[model samples]
Target: MIATYSGDTMGTSWSLQAVAARLSVVRGVQAALDRIVAQMSQWERESDLSRFNRAAPGAWHAIPNEFADVVDAALMIRRASDGAFDPCLGALTERWGFGARGSVDRVPQHADNGGDNRQIDFDPQNRRIRRSVDAFLDLSGIAKGYGVDLAAEWLLANGVRHFLLEVGGELRAEGIRPDGQPWWVDTEVPPSSSLAPWRMALHDSSAATSGNYRRGFTVDGRRYSHSFDPRTGQPIVNGVSSVTVLHRSCMIADGWATALTVLGPQAAISLADAQKLAVCVIVGDREYISRPWRDMLG
Candidate 1:
């Protein structure tokens, strides 16, 4: 029998389903996620990430292995996406009123990217990071995915072979259900929209969805998305509602979902095709699915 458990982390909720695993494993799983938040959360003033962000320019600070892993993946995706998935955009995000400072009705004024101030050099081999300027590193795009993966890792190490794990809306599935069926999940669509949910059967795979509808504020009838274009240092004006990405690593899926969302529909399709990413992009009810998405669904 599988036991279900859930708690909170990363300013969101986490849930798990384990087949033939001890209930006490929940404590270990929770601890694993807590470790990630302790090191990565900018919301926590004392978190390693927060301390690093507040340090002097050119100062190198030691980071935990968990933080380094996310940074490595983020830097790889940033290069692969040509800065569309920049982890170094925390300052821009805050300028757009989406970072640790919280939301605002009026958009904040800032020059575009301010030329090199939003840059970071991470040394994963030494588990350290250096800021070229006063840069804030934000991982809102991918840290939740890492928490999901780490929780699943804890479960696997504790003898759980069959399970599905989730933090916020990001998901990772392993093995099959007790009935020998893959975990079936549906991608989230904007509320009150005429969009159909995209469903998939997941086993040993992960999925993450990024949508403009999740966070933002409306001013003068214009809905400002929390999604900031790192290239422009402004909130993206793209018409995209959401992008869902499927991959073996939830962290990559999460980052790619955000990257593709910033790239918008047509551009995202091209990049998804080139990367062989299984992705579905929704723009005001117009659904665009890549070849990999179609192939994976079939």
Candidate 2:
């Protein structure tokens, strides 16, 4: 049987019927996820993408298609949202004391609409991106969701027909669990008012939530979100607390959730309607709202 824990850091469970093979598969999947994380992590100064961050302007280097693909997805979301979400907002994030080493209680001016991410440009076709200023690429917004998708792929390839894979808070499920129920999750925030969680039966889909509660800092006696607005180059200060997105692909759901959260309730609702993206938003007061498509849940 798979060793299960009530409060494991991963917050997940797996049945032990196919115990031996499942462990092997999970290990392989974990290894693969680690590799992808290393390659994409902005924190690792030695990572390939990190090297690009340090390169001089106009320099082009041959990058792996895998890396290209991940950044390409990020860039697509950046463009698709008209700059509502940005991966190139690393410069401001650090200056605001959200980076490797940050000075607590000091709110930098660039934390608002005066950051350096405006100079970064991504070119999808050439697999080359440029930054006129020094900056970092923070994948905190979408990495876990991408990892979930990767894990699901690994499980499916192993002939596992029924499973739920979650890394961080991004999750994907297929078929039914050992109890013969579609694997599900709750979309409620923890009692702390500091953590918003999600619940859903992910039989053939992926779900992800983005929130401002866990990753915020007090600045000038007010709280500011880590989510940056690409269009204005500032952190989102809206009242909407969290957003959960569901879609066929975990990556899309993950990216869109963050984007929609930054957009807040009204704008997110409008975008959900326009793009037909299935979404749910929980305002600061605990009232949950969702796209009309979520009416299918009834």
Candidate 3:
């Protein structure tokens, strides 16, 4: 029998299922996830991330090892995606009313276009980070994926080999189910569609999906998506509806999903192909699959 447990974290729910059933193990997993939220949640005022966002500029601040790891991943992806995905868009996110502080009445002026990820400095040796500009660091795009990974790690350490771990919509599956089958997941068809959902099997891999379909608002007949282009400080008007990425690390899959969504379908497809990443991009009624992702599906 697979043991299952779930709770709230990072403004979303997290669920875990393992082959080993133990209350102690479940509590430990919950604790591990809670620690991640305490350290990385931008929505929580007392979170380490929030404190870092409000810290004085030009001074290096010590960070938790896990936090530093996520930052390092974000910076690497930022370079790989050519700024399509950025963690330094906190100011722009807030200006667009997508921040922890909530929404505002009108679009704020885009003065500085926020700052680039290059402005932030990371010292992996000491797990320290410092920001040169006034930009607020937001890890919402990638932190939850780390949370999922942490939960999975805890289960593995507890000797639970076959499991599926999910935080919010991000997920990672390891080994096989009790019935000796791979964990299967379904990709939702874009909103307002009558089409059947696409299905994929996960084996020792992670998947994350990013889209503007459910989280945008209309202002004066103009639609503004929650996703913003870090380079322009403006909402992306790209034709792509959603992007799903599969990787060995949930954190990388999560960040790449958002990055590819921002890049739109064509550019996203090209990058996914070049990187040999498994990705599925949905544009309008059409779906595009990268070579790696196609192999996975087959």
Candidate 4:
């Protein structure tokens, strides 16, 4: 018997279901996701990588496997984006008032002390993390997509051949929907009365959107977005409203969305082409394009 549970998890609506001969497996998967969240949330704070606001210097100590996994993903995106997308933006993120705490009236511009590329010491053998710089990290870039992927894996492992998993709007689809159609989701846009939402379909793929339009603030006549440029320690003022990436894994899609959001359309497109990655970026006024979006959907 398959069972389903729908509730708020990680500050967003989520549902999990599974197809096992016995009903208990679905419940188990839900419990598993919940447990992972509980553990990751704590690791996000105590880990040295999250050094925003109050993260003490010299606290770059080894953490557990969960923290290691997030660091691993962040490092991947950092290298992929040539340091455009980084985990070390925690201090910069909070400096611009985008962390667990809110804004400050003023912040110092980032000092280019060659501190950006400070290597994080992660002993995979020991599953620990160490950092040489006084940096802060935020897994917000990759965590949701990683969580969604984990849930999808859990369901598929339990014989759920058809399902959709979403966390904080990052999504993944596997097999088929119950109705026997490819799982489709709209490319979400700001709700303007004059504009209609863009839609896309998915089949055994993942998609994620990162945007300043959805989450941001203004202070002293300056606008700030949640997407922090780890390189500059400043909010990106790019005209792009949103960038969505489609990829094989929800984790990669989520990370690339943030990376390309920072990169904006032109540069992002260049990098995506160079890497042969599938991506779509939506700028303000609904102008958008993805070179391989049509082909990827097919």
- TM-score per prediction, in order, is 0.96, 0.85, 0.95, 0.83
Q: State each candidate's clash count.
A: 0, 6, 0, 2
Better of 1 and 2 by TM-score: 1
* TM accuracy, model 1: 0.96
Q: lDDT per prediction?
A: 0.86, 0.67, 0.84, 0.69
lDDT of 1 by residue, 153-172 (tens): 87887788899998899999
Q: lDDT by residue for model 2 over 1-298, one digit each (tens)?
A: 2222111122233222222244466575666566665667666677776787678765556566666666778878877887777777666677766665554686665434444434556567777666665445766677667766776777678886676666666777777767667776776463446544545676789877886676778867888777767666666877767787888888888888888878878888888878788787777556455555567567
* Candidate 4 lDDT over residue span 1-298, tens digit each: 3345565666677765433334565565566567556545423454344332254455445665656777788898889898888766655556566665666666456563434454565577777666555555567788778778777777777767776667778878777656667776887675542345657778889888886777667668876777866676667877777777888888888888889888878898888877777777777665455567646656
- Candidate 1 Cα misplacement greater than 4 A, ranges: none
- Reference-based lDDT, residue 233, model 1: 76
Error of 2 at 132 (Å): 3.2
- Rank the candidate models, highest TM-score first: 1, 3, 2, 4
Residues 102-182 of candidate 3: C-alpha lDDT, one tens digit per residue: 887666665654344437888989999998665688888888888888888887887888988888789899999989999
Structure candidate 1, residue pairs in collision: none
Q: Rank the candidates by lDDT, best first.
A: 1, 3, 4, 2
Off by over 4 Å in 4: 1-4, 16-29, 42-62, 103-118, 192-196
